[model samples]
Target: MTTLKSGDKAPDFEGVNQDGKKVGLQDFSGKKLILYFYPKDNTPGCTAESCNLNDNYNAWLEKGYEVLGVSPDSVESHRKFKEKFNLEFDLLADTEKEILQAYGAWGEKNMYGKKYMGVLRTTFVIDENGVIEDVFKKVKTKDHTNQILKSLNI
Candidate 1:
């Protein structure tokens, strides 16, 4: 769905987080960023992916990486989801799908033989300079942290 490739410059984005704080690309200028776009909040797959990241949050931090989740859900929804799951990362509220579109994570999808436009689960590993280091289109929700670590050869 996304035209963004491994070496492309990650598109600049700004959105409100669960705490209603404005967050943007510039906020993480000198750190490796794990930007994951999921279809919705609290869904089974989404939860698994997020929880795995939360469980390994310190590992990521120790490896110099920061994680951020994005979805078209509202801030209130994000807040509830984060609290329920005890998520340790910021979940961006992209209600308008602006950031999703910029990253090419919003696109048509098929399920149960029905086609509709929705968010494509994707993860972009961005370097300190904001250049994409790797793209994970086939994300393994249950083992996402290990997947990322393997990608980074950590």
Candidate 2:
């Protein structure tokens, strides 16, 4: 779960996208950003969540929001995932986990009673000025876009 809350200043991050292009918080200055962190690329839940965002990407863009997905996957993996799914936004490659940790997205996860450190599925809605507008810690994969839109009242 994320410790960040609404009205908090979103932590700045710099990482490479699927195309190996450097992406940083400053790159989205004056723009609302949907920075979502997930466990892995090409997984079932992750794919569902990403596809939901992808399917509604134009709506988000029309609402003046840009989407960026992050995970501890390599650039090549992200590239393949984006290509396979025809994702319309950038997918950041956080193989080093630096960006994930900064957003409190990387932590211990329990699955089948097995505990291990990994990325926690979380979404941070950042305003135009970089302040967090909302933090969705328990995201519903299939309805994530609706959740975000409702939170923003858009």
Every model's TM-score: 0.98, 0.96
lDDT of 2 by residue, 1-154 (tens): 4488899999988999999999999999999999999998888999999999999999889989999999999999999999999999999999889999889999998999999998889999999999999999899998999998887887
Residue pairs with colliding backbones in model 1 are: none
- The candidate that achieves the highest lDDT relative to the unseen native structure: 1
For 1-154, candidate 1 gives per-residue lDDT tens digits of 4599988999999999999999999999999999999999989999999999999999899989999999999999999999999999999999999999999999999999999999999999999999999999899999999998898898
Candidate 2 at residue 123, lDDT? 97
Error of 1 at 45 (Å): 0.4
- Which regions of candidate 1 deviate over 4 angstroms? none
Global lDDT of model 1: 0.95
- TM match of model 1 to true structure: 0.98
Clashes of each: 0, 0
